[model samples]
Target: MCSRRRWGTSPRRGRARPICSTWRADWPGRAVPTSRNFSPWRHFLHELAGVQPDDPVPLDDVAELRAWKERFPTRLEALLGPLPSAVPPEVEVVSSEDCGRYRRDKIVFDVEHHLSSPAWLLVPHDRETPGAAVLAQHEHGLGRGKDEVCAVDGGDDGLREHIRTHRSDYGHQLAERGYVVLATDLRTFGERADWNPPHLYACDLTHVHAAMLGRNLLALDLWDLARALDVLCAHPLVDPARVGMVGLSVGGTVTLFLAAWDTRVKAAVVSGYFSSWASSAAVAWNMCGSQVLHGMLGRLEHVDLAAAIAPRPLLVESGTRDDLFPIDVARAEMAKLARVYDRLDAAAHLEHDVFDDGHRWNGERAYPFLDHWL
Candidate 1:
């Protein structure tokens, strides 16, 4: 039997009524209510998720863009909540080893007072000059975490399969190209995944605790990621002026938000997760609590928040058949980004590639995009 449930986005109103898929099993072959005849609130949510939402682009001018940077983050804060300010991340390199073309240093660093991050710092072997760097991000690969991007030994088989299937080892690939690459486990993945929650769902509890502590998962992750920027800048072999970031799935969510919040990122490649938040989060219901920014729909959609990264080099990559993040919505967001960049006279800095593939990392334009921007 299908259980009936309702969700309220605002305190006084239920803005959407998303049906559970349980009905499919309750009546094996009976025709069900199509999404076409969904309630008005659900349709509104769908419109927000699709290209039909009313996000009239703000006029492109120096004044508006400047004001947007200041105002937009504040509005986003209303959804994602407050974050601890940036602090010196006293880094501790735990171990180092040569891996042929590069040496990987396993390290720990503090994001703020209470939390610390474990990361792999990949440096070009037998090199000395300061060069560009990338804060490579990891996706939600069935179950694989940061290792999916770093391709390190001792990773779980699922992430290993994720590596083989998606060629998700962009961090190692970038390090071999002579750029310092920092691949850190996000809040609830890899080393971070093992949590002492009072619930069965560890990831869900972490995000819940984050929200109860006055912020959502995205806010907390971005705060720590900005601190990762501090660590990247402090490294001897990294040129502080030329830092970029890349991620495939949830990692792309971080790349988008972090680049929007932290100005230090000079360039970014967001793969697999640049769709309309509504399209992916509202419709598919495939997002983790870590991806939630409660009630983000009313203020600014994905494209509006991304405008904070305008005038900087950014490349959005998406696959045509990605089940989680549909390419159709990705193009809509891309078009909005292009309009904002074109108005700023920095159109060339923004590029998006829709490759003919599925929901995986297609690194065709990623390396070149960073090379040109950095």
Candidate 2:
């Protein structure tokens, strides 16, 4: 059977059904969303919510697009906090393993002033040089870090099963396809989580600490991603000029923002996360702390941030039955962003795949899209 047609027929599909069937909850971390005084609180937030109606005028020229792009990033900085400046740390190899067509290296590097990050760099064997590369970010899955994407040994059976259900190994997939791939853990996962007290989920505690200091995790995550781009470009075989990023869930959240902030990401594929935040975050409340940007809606819509990468090849994947980002909303915002891309005379560069599946990596379209563009 075609794999796409078998999204629901995998051996563990029955066990994984509840992972998506239970809406308002995110898998791998944190609790299900709950607005205690549902109606009153929602209305209260609605009064304060401020996703402005995007400029209706199509950007007819590059100059107009440039103006549109310049208008919002400053406001975003105020909301997400400033993107940091850090010297690139030297890459250290911890281990390397041959994973069939690709060789995987377990490496570590400093992403911030004192923050070290664990990552897996997967490079294809007997491959051509000056080829494309992808910075693949994994889902915001609890305890899942670079290991999940690199198909590294997870030690725990449950963790391995979770990775299987999510198909969260696309970094390995991309590398085996001949693209150099770097999969990095974010702030709260893997060895970085060692600092927090043992009982706490790192994400929960990290959110609290970041907020206590009047900063947000989103800022740090973005800075780490930007720095990682520099490292990816430094790879000898990677075409520094041709790099892209693809992620699922929170990773998709990072993908859109990374592309927006850095032009070095020549192309992108954002899966399972780009929809009307007005509908999901505001109403359904299906968002996490790490993904939040205070007052983001006041200046820009999700589609607008996405369009900031306009005229570049972009493919957004949405599952028709995915509750996290409803298909109707995904299609609506996609149409809106398509118009923005159309302004640059690069409408063909913008596309969306409405998959007949749920929230996971739907690479049937994404892989080809990246290969075509990068």
Candidate 3:
């Protein structure tokens, strides 16, 4: 037998009453309560706890490290889908100006047959010969893109404030220190942003579109950056052998992956984005589609991907108060990566600069690290 109780007031009593229900079987009576406090995200977190890599890459020795490096990037590239054929950048200088310690030139170059990237090339006045060059990447923001890193004047007050607060003008800083800096917009930003009717920040939309085509927005951007490297290396003022990269936030994501994939980047400074994938995934807005590797979660962690840059000079900057990436996880991940460097006998090549702040660039150690390595 089953009994039901209506919520609120009982019809016969015409007054408020407690609600209850019960069910009785052949043997006895029992009641089961329904819960209203469950969350799907909590279930997902539960599932994530059980997931682990099928074959975590071995870092036992130099042979294993070399073998892993040989095969991992190929696997990663395959996951990213096809890349556009390499072609001569066919660079064009659009304009130039004196900017205190460096001369900034506006240039455009082809990354694909139909696609081009706009950039600012900062060449220091004091350099007498070919010197180190750095690919300076910018974080996500309103329409400033490359301009933020190069510290171009006369943008909106918000942009100016962002630049000041984040210490984001590192490209300009690199120029002042005598390194040639190439600052460019990754797609769907600054001049590359969608300007049509019902315009929106297009990273999510663009990432969806690329995924439909079995491509990734990040892979596409990395290709563009590689071409940008070609342009930087070709510059008479730059020594191709002494190339490095520095970036904050989303820019740091690019710096980490690009330096890992392209050995041409002799040293790298990855700021504000080195925490584990699991940590980033815990926050919904932290992992963007553009930065996603399709099946990478169980197959690897951020440390595994970062280990590919082992034996190479890498400086990671983490802010103690960076709630997005979480400095605690960054420290743990860096410790894991340090083991890989230790195994490779390149322990000195790895450095972690933990500063007391939030998500932003801290060049105190980075500038010196790059100077010593590159």
Best by TM-score: 3
User: Cα deviation in Å at residue 168, candidate 1?
Assistant: 1.0
TM-score of candidate 2 to 2 decimals: 0.83
TM-score winner, 1 or 2: 2
Error of 2 at 301 (Å): 1.6
Instruction: Assess each prediction's global lDDT (C-alpha) against the native.
Output: 0.80, 0.79, 0.84
Q: Which rank order by TM-score, best down to worst?
A: 3, 2, 1
Off by over 4 Å in 2: 1-40, 43-45, 48-64, 195-201, 283-285
> In candidate 2, which residue pairs clash?
28-142
Indicate the residue-level lDDT of 171 in model 1. Answer: 95
TM-scores for every candidate against the unseen true structure: 0.82, 0.83, 0.87
Q: What is the per-residue lDDT of model 2 for residues 97-117, given as tens digits with 9 covering 90 to 100? A: 898898888888887776777
For model 3, the run of ten residues with the poorest summed lDDT:
22-31
The candidate maximizing lDDT is: 3
